[model samples]
Target chain A: MNPVKVIINKELKVIFNSLLFYIAFTVFFCTTGFIYWLSQGNIFYTGQASLGYLFTVFNGVLFFLIPALTMKSISTEKRDGTFQLLFSKPIKTWQLLAGKFFAILIQVLLCLALTLPYYITIACLGHVDHAVGFCGYLGLIFTTGCYISIGIFVSSLTSNPLIAFFSTFAITIWFQFLFEMLSSWLGNTFIASVFMYLSVNDHFDTISRGIIDSKDIVYFISIISLFLALARYVICKSRI
Target chain B: MNVIVKDLTKIFDYQKAVDSLSFEAKKGEILGLLGPYGAGKSTTLKMLAGLLRPNQGSIHFDNYTYEKNESKIKKLIGYLPEKNPLYDAISVTDFLFYMAKLYDIPRYKVTSRVLDMISLCGLENEKHKLIKELSKGYRQRLGIAQALIHDPEVVLLDEPTTGLDPNQTFGIREIIKTLGQEKTVILGSHILSEIENTCDQVMIMSKGQIMAQGTTAELRQAPNSDFSLKIVIKGGEIPAIQEALNQLPQIKSLQLQHKQEFEVHCTPGQEIERAIFELCKDNDWYITEMTPVQMRLEDIFRKVTQKQ
Candidate 1:
């Protein structure tokens, strides 16, 4: 078997067995469910069967949820000295990171898959744009990949999971909101355009609106690759 | 597989944890790394395990160098790091299976391998229990089991018996001795006697440098090595006996433990025993007891490490 698959299997088994995963899943399910059905801008209030509002709420909730799920991925391994066990095996550092990245991504995907009933219910009530829903889910998946990579990167920077959690949350906040805010405040300057391009929310907004632009896809892929590369670099440098 | 390490060095912050250290171990040999705390034994073992990259060194297993064949070398090595770090949340069986899979054991073979380690490590009763619930001794055994789960040719163990009871230590030593019969094993410990009893070759290190390296008997026979004898005489007066023992050129010093018992220090490679027997025969002192005390590894360890 591939070592990455072994790591992924172990990681998933560990996560699923821990109480933390269930709590994160519950909080995600509840918060998104309440916002979609019972909150002020709920579907009942808007009288619209579209999942646009629910996708926006998911975008907001996942900002914190992804970090929660990924906080312990690498940092805990370093803290527990299990990195020695993994690194000493016939496994490359990238394989280790890739395994963890996909394990956590699988978790986020599982959580999202559980909410498919919301889509079905909305479709039953009124005519729903299947294309928009599919694109919105794709956007969330890309956003999840981007956030998970960032979380794993920050996780590699420290041996403390709390620090990994907060740093990831703090960094994603910048990409999700602060960069966009700063770009708007700069009034369309070249640096502002760079900031806009850097903002994860900008690309997510474009894709979630039922339009899959190559530029947006490229933005998410580059961000994911950049952070994964950075994470690999951090691990390599620190192991010495 | 024979393992060779050359000029291995690891610096943390600005301090050298392992200086330009080097050694070699052939198949069927157990090379013990003996040192006090902060003497870089663990650092050296970590480098050998390929978990830590050396600042200036190279390691090779048989014909494969780490620089060119890291994975190949890793597949042949089994390392038990200090403190026996394990995944506490998993069962003993799960942890071993996880390790087996990580080492790329065939799917059909992993279960049997895990079972073998569980039995070899004496962890059959605790196989279903989570590792967190295990005692320190069981944990150490589990650590060794995981290191050996893949049946690697080279085993590197860092302080494998650090916190075990006498019985547990004996069990671990038995396992190590069994491993040394067929594989190249490098064992690191600060405990001198453990190394003396278990290793084929001993390397005494201090401050990241090797102070002495040789077989146990070779180290014991080094120049300036001294032996002692405990003698008890029945007939001679204390002063006369002391004088007679002192007159022997081979006897260095004498201490009277009780009225009739005397402790005599003798220069190494001397006929002090025969000389004392002859002296007692001439003086009409009846010899009751005489026991030779061999030079201990502790003395050699202190002698070499304290010099620096």
Candidate 2:
């Protein structure tokens, strides 16, 4: 058996068994459902008849949701000595990091899969561009990969899951929102462009426009690899 | 597997946790590592198990050195770290099967192997229960089962019985003894009596260095300058036994202390226990008891470690 698959199976089993997953699943769908349908700023109330906010609003929910999902991925194992059990096995640090990253990514994908009905509902009511919605989902997944990597990296820094979650949140809030805002507010064009390029939201925005640019893809992949690499290094150093 | 660790050292926080420790373990031997808390017993085992990369030295299992060939070495060893760690959310059966998969056991063989481990560790009754619901003993059993699921040749158990009650420790100890009959087992603990009762060979470690390593009897006799033996013979043949003892070249001196009791002193570097019994067999004299008097393991360990 591949070590990554074995780990993913364990993570999925734990996630499915957890009541907290169900709670998060509920809160996520409820908030998204309310925002897109019943709320005053909703597409339904504004008669826009488009699910344009789906990616952006869901990304907002995921900003907090993913850190909670990934906080214990590495930290809890370290705290309870399960990492010792794992490190003793014939697996590398990269396998451990990849296994955990994809485990939380799959959970996020499952939650997104549940919201497919909303997409169907919106499609039935108005003229929706299928290509654009597809790109939005793709961008959402790419951005999630970046966030999961960040979460796992922070989780490896400490044994406390709360610290992992909060540090991840603190770091990602800048990537997810603050950097993009800072980029626009800055008067210097060079500094603004650097922040703009660095921000996850900006790259995600480019991809979310239904355009699959190679540069944007490279940006997300680079961010994911960088954080995952950092996480692997942290785990190796800490275990030694 | 015949295991050799040479100059195995690990430095943590600028202090050497395991300092140039070296030892050899023969195939199918149960070697107990006795040490105080933080004495590097676990660290040495971890280095052998490939959990920790040693700063200096090498661990060689037969022809394969650990640093040169890790995956091959890993397949030959199973390590259960100090605190027995397990996934509490998973059922016992699921966890074992998962471990079988992790060990890369063939898909068809996983069930039977897991069943064997479940029975071997006495976890059959709790096989369906979640690990979180288990008592401390059950958890420890599960930990051992995972360590053995793949049938590795070298099994490392660090403080396996640390927090268990006597009964729980007994169960794990029995399993370890059974494993020792066919596998090289390294049992690490700070408990003097635990090592004495369970291990065939013992290595006393302190301050990241090995103070001494030998069989219990050898270690007991190693430190004693005077070699003494107590013999009890039937038919009250005191003079005959004393004369027979006097004829042996290894016997430095012999005396009949009582009618049925005789004491023989052996020269240095002589193992007289086997020779005395052989002498009784040859003379047609029935020996009721032949005991080698020596220091206890506790005394030997304290004496060897504290001196350094």
Candidate 3:
């Protein structure tokens, strides 16, 4: 097997064996399930038989969940000195980062898959726009990928998991809301447009609305790649 | 493979950790790096293992250099760091299998290789145990097992037996000696006896520079060229024995050790033993005991390292 696959398998096994995985999985499922059904402005209140509200709520839930899942990816390895063990193999720095990236992505995807019951209920109630629903899931996957990449990059910067967690949360919060907020405050300027474009919320919004623009896809991919590249660079520089 | 390191240097925060160190180890040779703490032994081994990049100079394993063939070079090296970091949550078998896979060992052979390492490191009983539950000696054995699981041509071990008991240290040294028969093995430690027992070529390092380098016998012979002998005689007056020993030119210095025993420092390359036997025979003094005291590596290590 290749080094990336070996790393991913080890990572997944470790994640599954830990109590943290069960806790994160339970909390994410319960919170998203409760908000979609029992909370105010729930499906029954709108009575629209659409997943639009659920997707919006999911965006917020995932903003926090992704960071929690990815906070220990690289930081724990650094702190425990297992980075030496991994790098001693024939694996390149990017392959290691990519392995961790996909492993966390797989975990988040598993959590998202559990919400299929909500989708089933909505589809049973009335006609659902399948295109928007598909796009919404795609948008969630893209957004989760971007968040994990950013989290891994932050995790590489420090050996403390708490610091990795908080810094990732801080940075994702800026991308999720602060950028859009700043863009709105500085209305109609060139820098404002740049901030608007950088905001993850705007691109996710565009993709979830059933408008599969190349620009949105490019934006998400670029952010993921950029952060992963930065993570690789950080690991390489730290070794020296 | 022959491993050659030339003018290798590593600077940390403007302080040299390994200062232009150079050496070579041929295949089937064990090179021991002996140094005190902070003498850069670990740093040198790390650079050789490709865990750290050197600030200058180069390393070549056979025809391969790290610059153009880092992955290739890595594939040929098995390194156990000083701290021996491992995944505490994983079982020993799983960890070994994972390392085998990482090194791209053939899938069909990984199980057999893992089994080989488990038995070789004497970790048979602990193979199913979580690493966190094992004692430090077992953990160290597991560390070495993982490093050797891939069967790399070059093995770099940093203080492989730092905290083990005498038995465990002996086991590890035996394993190292076995590896030295077929691989280019570089063992780093500050323990003089361990190095003296296992290394074919010994390098004593101080302040990031090599203070002495040669075979154990050669190094032992280099400094303190004089050899000593302990002799015990009976049925002769102490003054007469002392006078007879003092008359011999080979006896440089003599100290009365006990009632009838004397410690004699002899000049090198002389027939001092025969001369003492002949003198005792002629004087009617029976030689009760005679034993030569060889110079030890410890004395040389102390003398060279403390020179700074």
Q: Among these predicted structures, which one has the highest TM-score?
A: 1
**Considering only N, C-alpha and C atoms within 3 Å, which residue pairs clash in candidate 2?**
none
**Residue pairs that clash (backbone atoms under 3 angstroms), model 1:** none
Question: What is the DockQ of the complex in model 3?
Answer: 0.75
Candidate 1 lDDT tens digits, B176-292: 999999999999999987998899999999999999999989988887777888989878689988887878888888899998899898877788878888888898988889998
Label model 1 with its docking quality class.
high
lDDT of candidate 3?
0.92
| Root-mean-square deviation (CA) per prediction | 1.8, 6.2, 2.7
Evaluated at residue B200, the lDDT of candidate 1 is 100
Q: What is the lDDT of residue B95 in candidate 2?
A: 93
TM-score of each: 0.96, 0.88, 0.93
Off by over 4 Å in 2: B223-293
Q: What is the interface RMSD of each candidate, in Å?
A: 0.9, 1.2, 0.8
lDDT of 2 by residue, B1-308 (tens): 89988888899989999999989888879999999998899988888877788999988899998657887877778888898988899999999988888788899999999999999999979999999999999998999999999999999999998888999988988999999999999999999988998899999999899989899988866745457788888753667777777889899888777778887777657778778778877888788887876767888888878876
For model 2 chain A, the run of ten residues with the poorest summed lDDT: A44-53
Better of 1 and 2 by DockQ: 1
